[model samples]
Target: MTDGLEGARERRVRTGEGVELCVAELGDPAHPTVVLLHGYPDSKEVWAPVARRLRDRFHVVLYDVRGCGRSSAPKPLRGGFTLEKLTDDFLTVLDAVSPDAPVHLVGHDWGSVQGWEFVTVRRTEGRIASFTSMSGPSLDHFGHWIKKRLARPTPRRIAQLLGQGAKSWYVYALHTPVLPELAWKGPLGKSWPRILRKLEKVPAGAYPTPSLPTDAAHGAWLYRDNIRSRLRRPRDDCYAHAPVQLITPTEDAFLSEQLYDELELWAPQLTRHTLPAKHWVPRTRPDQLAVWISEFATASEPDAAGVPAQLAAPRTGRYAERFGGQLVLVTGAASGIGRATAFAFAEAGARIVVVDRDAEGAARTAEMARLVGAPDAWPETVDVGDGQAMEKLAARTAAEHGVVDVLVNNAGTGVTGDFMDTSVEDWQRTLDVNLWGVIHGCRTFGRQMAERGQGGHIVNTASAIAFQPTRALPAYATSKAAVLMLSECLRAELAGQGIGVSAICPGVVNTNITATTRFVGTDEEEEKRHQDRTTRLYGLRNYPPEKVADAVLRAVIRNEAVVPVTPEAHGARLLSRLSPRVVRALARVRPRV
Candidate 1:
């Protein structure tokens, strides 16, 4: 057993076929039961991370499938691991654990394969309240998918069939005689942990267990007994009796996302969630998985009439397909571009986290985000320049709201003056908020994203002035230039990890930044006049902050390195690349004020 499940209560569940299964329970027995089933070649300990997360909220149950872990293998290994026998094992465990109440079923890989069976069969109808599947497909549904494509013979469908066939190479190998059994019990089982770490980026830990050799050898039978029979003659009435949540790992090596194209035909009330991770999400992305499972299971409860109603309504936002159920955090979200970006993500059904130095303003933005369509929204007050405070905020956000899927480092201040005239204090303050702020946000939150091994996006709000030289605003331009470079460097470093870094450059947007902009080397009266003049000029330009917000979303979707938001920003970028002399000439011109 893993350390996380140390205190779990143990029970022995005996199936009628003389198979003994090991079951473990955590949390209150009276609470709603959530049964977690492990995939092939994995013991119940594979769910230690997820089980620990869910134990506080619900009664969590985990059991090794027969022949996998502490469970006893059937007398004969040949036809022992069929789906019918697995179903019998499931019923026996369910009867022993929560005989009175139905359970919320959660599964990964082969476990998900079995879950599809349990949810669709008539005998297990009222015993299961909801089913959440990840990295697995029902053999029956897959059979139908293959039959339809072969019948149609479309080019696209044929290509999809070929692609999935290539991915299923291991399946064929697994069914080939005693060689698979020999490999698993020998060098293959010994090196499996290292393979997972290198390929899937699964952290090194006390998982896979010492029983892996025996487990894997026995598990090859799972494919041999079921794969051929089900795919040849799939059941027509294999429709789900309960609400189903399908969590697809976009980077899964074994399955194609296209396998579920016709899933809605089988499951009427299906909710889909896509994660940028690999196949073993139970260990790699347990935090996110726990959150999703909790939300889905809660919504499936009999008392959660409002939850299902809210989910049933289709989202109309353009980015809903990409961002729905994602968590987005925006700094300086009280007003201007930050606020607009928060609202835009909210409209796509993403959970919102509004961060700003202004507490009330952040709270207001969060409130508006919830009203707009966010499933959940929260406000966090912290100065991005304060490293310690940002660290605490990042920790709190992760612990409270889960890791941020999208981070927008938008908080910044404005400083305008010639290089010689700008005070040291002016430069320091400007760089602290504009450049160091981006650094702090990326360092704190980006680390969590990287550690989680799930892909995420980071957007740093630079300025058009970064590429387009400005004579008057020395301090602001320098700070923004640093931000642009930082974003570029970070992008290259994180590209391999699937974390995208985008620098958003916007030319003059009509916002409150100008009203508060500092004009150094000027008297109070002169500074006030300069502020007003700049603010008025920006207002006359009439560029909406919402456009910049839209660009932020587009940048994340495209994984763009640098985005020029407005017409002037685009022109300036083009000039910087194509005609440096013209850009220099434009920069030499004095401000109107």
Candidate 2:
């Protein structure tokens, strides 16, 4: 017999890494666990009410993610606060508390970013079943979004500059050892409440100022080591693949909502949710949060080994499950692997938005997406090769769906020809779809998510050809390689902004691509001859597109930027790394069909 109220209080515990974290335990310990991570300017106390609600059904856990609240914030910072370090912090807590068992994970603001990254990098989705994210974007898309949006006229520029300056105040201070200490001890401490109050859309009469110290220093370390460093170290490869739940507070004062455009490219296995509260939804609507957490912690799913151990896993055993309510937008989604990936995401529980140049094909795919259990699937016909059209599509999709929590830039074209045979138009079209399409998605939706200050995810489709280019198809190879590089660069650049970027690469997939692509030739006989030559020269075997979709889901959860979809592709990649010349020679010795 228990009152279930004892769980709401904060406690201190040691993590696997020997770091002592100030943890708040809510709900009965006997029930399944749910770990809650707090963001900057806050503590575990904010989750008290929410924890209480879940006490009877869930063993809810809340902790300050290494710094802030009662967690140990070592002088000069312990382990530094890069996303990898931050992810380790979460893992430490989980491993120490839950051991090898899985738990439900929930995060808000910076917490959400860390949560997603933790599950991906640690491959802890096996131990941590689901994620409920509030306000975070994929780092890759976020950087592209910020760059494009900030490049606008004077007013927007001024606002961005001011916003970055204001938000970066603590960031600048943390660069030096002396100022962080001074600020923590003096004026910065005194103004903490006022600053936090200004950042929220809370009514004046809602709650008293939290009786917590204004230690912005601990939080600033995250920005410096994780955010800023990632930006400076653009082109680093880091991506995550995991199932996530994203919650957006409609009335958030600090983070805007519009930046979530084309977020589906980032997390195909994402669920979109909303709360009609202020920035402090955990504090304001704690009970609702608790209910959601409880539901997520108790749900179950099958664990399949559909994904590689380095990527994602297929549904197999029963595990805790989270609700699904995400809207995913996929560009170049109508045919080939894009359509199959869209259908796969839908089957995993997502509202799908199928886009392509062919309206009828897109509609048919949308119908399939819906059949796979998407709450609502939409189809839009647009030329991904056109920048203006992509912008319009992004805007329209956001307006229609409210938020694109997941975005997959799976639309691309492969124009295979001898470098000498390929014209400028061939190169432009290939670049337009393969590189520029992804760029457009990041700019349109990523900016909106960034302005909103919530983090999101973006997935750009490249090809194995990007990693190990063949002598032929120079234009196609260059375009895909560029996409891969772009995804890597964005991953580093947008770490602080909370956006994650993953570059998806698949081997040859069986589809109508040979027929649909604009392959220039004289007559029908000549085109057939070209096709036969390509088949004979490459010895290409088409894998199913659904397999690529499975790979995409895995990549998202694991936060891997470079995802090779096939065993052959992986082998080729390894060969390229070990001996480029040997790999090239092997590729040259293709068997004739």
Candidate 3:
């Protein structure tokens, strides 16, 4: 009880099964109750980080299951750790905490497994208002999944079965007779904290290891009692009785994402989330998890905070599940691709920070982002070309709105000219915004994301000219080429830190960038004419900025290093990779403009 939850009032509730469950309570009891549950090899201490964040708004509760932490293990632990018994323990805790009001249930790992049991079984129905699950699936659903796969056994299904089987080697290890107990009580126990830090990215000294060995040793019965039986004869009536939120860790080693392919069949009221983290999100990404859990729990209480009708509905955007509640910053969001990208993320329910050199335009974009479904949006006026301003913007963003989960380095100016015709001023201006802007963004905000220790994404907008060089636009091509290299280098550098860097090549989508484009060595009238002609040609192509925006989101979700958005952009990329001589020949041709 005293492990990590400071100021938490702890008590022991004795179950009918004669097991004493250790329960911790925080916040005002009259507020909406939110129960936090941990998993195998972990006690209620695992929920400490997330619980701290939720205590202000909700009555937070944490409890060690019968056999773990400070709780008394059941007598004859073999059969005592069954899901049926676990359900009884949960009910006992629920009755002791809040008898009249239903509580919001949250779980991780084995806790999620137990939560699935709690939310699905009829005995506990009407007691749980909502259930948020991560890193665990229902035994019934898993059983169904296995049955379906074995029934068909296609090549793909066979491979999936084998893959999941390998990932679950630890489960098989625990099922071995006395080996698990020996390992947990011995060297494995002492080394677990180190293993978690090295593999799961859980920071050192943050994870509580004092009671881990004992807790883990006792917790093995959880797998022993429930896994084989339930997985073999999973209940047919195991359908969720409450709204469910499922957060899937993309890089989880123990579970496969495909396991939840048919989860909607079991959880009718479901919201899905995909995190780029590994297994232990509770420790590594508590901030993001807390936000999501609060949002999901709050959504259940429609009249509690005067919730709007639109906010109450399920998100319908493409990556809504992944991006919802995340903080995103987009530079050059006043117009063109940046504006479209801001709107796209807004529709996915991300909190937007719309930034641009133009104050009024940035404000307008922020307002539009909120209108489109962003939980909140703010405008900042800053020239990306100025390194000092970008640094201030980065610091202010972190201080005011939290570290941006996604940063779009999208501000750039277009320059068109032959190498000889381009002046020193033109080259400097082109490099300042196109190359140095991206440099400042990555150096400043990327550091913040790294310092936060949670993962984030950085999107740098390049141009097709980066790939397919042209004689007509030497200065623009050089700046974009530099951007492409920077993105590649940063991607490699940040791969270790869970930060992704993507270079997006948008080709020539119809945007007002033409208005700001500079034509070197051209007379004023001729420059205007070229700009008009280029804008008209781009309009005729009718490739929308929205498509490029979609590509940006997709690239981040997939962690793609380089993305070419339009058809021409894709073509240029392919040519650059497959036929450099052809690209060079094409580059030799002069543009009519």
> Which one is best on TM-score?
1
* Full candidate order by TM-score, most accurate first: 1, 3, 2
Candidate 1: minimum summed lDDT over ten consecutive residues — where?
Answer: 304-313
Worst 10 residues of 3 by lDDT: 302-311
Q: For model 2, how does the per-residue alpha-carbon lDDT over 3-26 read when each residue is reduced to its tens digit?
A: 222525666766555667766676
**Cα shift from native, residue 353, model 2 (Å):** 1.8
How far does residue 10 in candidate 2 sit from its true spot (Å)? 41
lDDT of 3 by residue, 1-593 (tens): 46678889999999997789899998999998999999989988888888888899999999998778889999888898988898998899989999977889999999999999999998897788899999998988999899999998999999988999999999988989988888988999888888887777676754665878788888999999999998899899999988899999899999999989979999988888888778999887776788889888988753545331223667888888889878899999999999999999999989899989999999999999999988779999999899999999988887565678999999989888889999999999989989998999999999988876677999999988899989988999999999999999999999988899999998878999997799988899999999999999989988999999999999998999999888888999999999999999999998887
Q: Candidate 3 — number of clashing residue pairs?
A: 0
**What lDDT tens digits, residue by residue, belong to model 1 across residues 1-593?**
44447779998888898999999999999888999999978899999988888899899999999898889999898899888889999999999998977899999999999999999999898888899999989999999999999999989999999999999999999989999999999999999999988888777877878999999999899999999999999999999988999999889999999999979999998988887779998988786688678878877875534223233545679897678778899999999999999999999878899999999999999999999988789999999999999999999998876788999999989988788998888889998899999999999999998987777999999999998898988889989999999999999999988999999999999999998899887999999999999889999999999999999999999999999988988988999999999988988887867
Candidate 2 weakest ten by summed lDDT: 314-323
Off by over 4 Å in 3: 1-20, 26-28, 75-80, 144-162, 302-313, 321-327, 375-383, 386-405, 414-429, 445-457, 467-475, 492-500, 514-543, 557-593
Cα lDDT computed for each candidate against the true fold: 0.90, 0.66, 0.89
- For residue 181, what is the lDDT in candidate 1? 93
